[model samples]
Target: MGSVTELKAADGFKLAAYRAAPAGASKGGLVVIQEIFGVNHHIRSVADRFAALGYTALAPALFDRAERGIDIGYDEASVQRGIKLRAAIKLEDTLLDVAAAVGALKGAGKIAVVGYCWGGSLAFLSATRLPGLACTVGYYGGMIAAHAQEKPKVPVLLHFGEHDHGIPMTDVEKVRAARPEVQIFTYNAGHGFSCDERASFDKASHEQALARTLDFFGKHLKP
Candidate 1:
């Protein structure tokens, strides 16, 4: 169970967010970053799932800066549209929105960030740029290698699909070599393996990656 709420970024830009709270006491907070598809049903579901696991989870509508109330499907046209919207938005602005969400969750205790697709790269960037995050996890972040020189201020975990055409193994290796301190893993699936709504969804990879992510959060975010 989650609800939509408004949040203001550091720059005074108001955006929408989906927030879910644990039924009882919260162990910590989790910031779930959305894919290029926006903070759609899948992202909300992710927040709800984390809430059920005893964390107050929030998913900010990052695309709200470019276009508000954007919820699109997983089609070729939608993919192209998402890419265009992402290109129009700046990473610095998105990180500001994420910092806003993290500020809103301050009372929940230690905070961690996890993201998918474009949000995945944003999550990694948050670990390196933002403050107050305990750790970070990213899935299939194609842009991570380009920014591998950036050092994370906190522990970070990254996952990639071995068959992901968007992210080559060479890029993954580059990140690994450049940032040996960051934990990196690869699965036998393609891009978007964690997304059940996509054709690339792989149940085995999703389950395994989720388990590792939860364990990482438990170790890093728990009080």
Candidate 2:
């Protein structure tokens, strides 16, 4: 389910991508965004999950500028490394990587973006900034609170945890108030709840969010 590939983003910045082909012809394409932790095993698993659902998936290494081959597990030191990596990279460049991943999946019938944590912010940006995107989904995007003015032309879904310290319920309400048309949901879990590798992982919430995302792609990504 893993294929190493190269993509060119803004200013011809070359980055690495992990791709998993859907078991059959893809009904759509899923552009999976990575967490602040980088495109680690968890992100790869997400791509495989989408592929299992018949959507060709690609996880872009948005932190390629910070470190080329960075894949860290969730230990204290590794978490610090991830934090530094997250702070080192720029959001503009990250979005460029996302755009490049979308371009690389040109053969798929339609394209949707799903992201977690930092990637979640990228998902929101994709829906608002990138053209030709079918839809977008974000899980606990902390940065989105600051970028609340951005709006999606296509459909969008957002999943957040009520207990998430990184993103408060007030900010979620602000987002909802700003974009009433977009679907938003809240769970009792915490930040990074969709990631099984993280301590915040909530199985029920993750499943429900995944189902809603699949349904969104189904409706928007018509072949």
Candidate 3:
């Protein structure tokens, strides 16, 4: 359902991406941002899911700037390594990679972005900074609070876990108060509730959030 492809950033940095296309005509395009773990199986599956929903989806390997081909599992050691790699790359650089992905999907029509965990925060930042986006969706983005003051240039949707230790409700409240226009939802779950590969995965919450996300994209990314 998907294949690995190469993308060139504006800075001439070449990175890898997993691209998935719809079986028939595409309704639009979707850019799926990856978690700190990189564009692993889960991220590729995410792209395939969106592709099945009639969008051309692309998941870029953002960690390529610091270290290429990074795909790790959900372990304490892997978490630490992902954090270090994420820190090594600058926000501007990450956006450049995201922009490259968005450019790659230009032919597929109106484009939207969806991300998880660290990628979630990047999705929000992409809405605020990047051009050619119809909307963006973010799930449990711990760093979003830091950028609450920045207004998004496009429609934004966000999901959060009520008990996520990494992202406090205070942070969600801050974002809500700062950006009242953004559609935000909370679930009775913990961090990584949407990822089945994680121990914190909650099927009920994931389903609800995914429904809302798809609806949002359908509304905004219409031809």
Q: Could you say which candidate leads in lDDT?
A: 3
Q: How many pairs of residues collide in model 1?
A: 0
In the range 59-137, model 3's lDDT, one tens digit per residue, is 9999999999999999999999999999999999999999999999988989999999999999999999999999999
Worst 10 residues of 3 by lDDT: 45-54
- Candidate 2 per-residue lDDT, tens place, 23-110, comes to 7788988899988777889999989888888888999888888889888887889878888998997777777788899988898888
Higher-ranked by lDDT: 1 or 2: 1
Worst-scoring 10-residue span by lDDT in model 1: 87-96
Which lDDT values do the candidates have, in the order given?
0.95, 0.87, 0.96
Q: What TM-score goes with each of the models?
A: 0.99, 0.96, 0.99
Clash totals for all candidate models: 0, 0, 0
Model 3 ranges with Cα > 4 A deviation: none
Q: Across residues 181-223, which tens digit of lDDT does each residue of candidate 1 receive?
A: 9999999999999999999999999999999999999999878
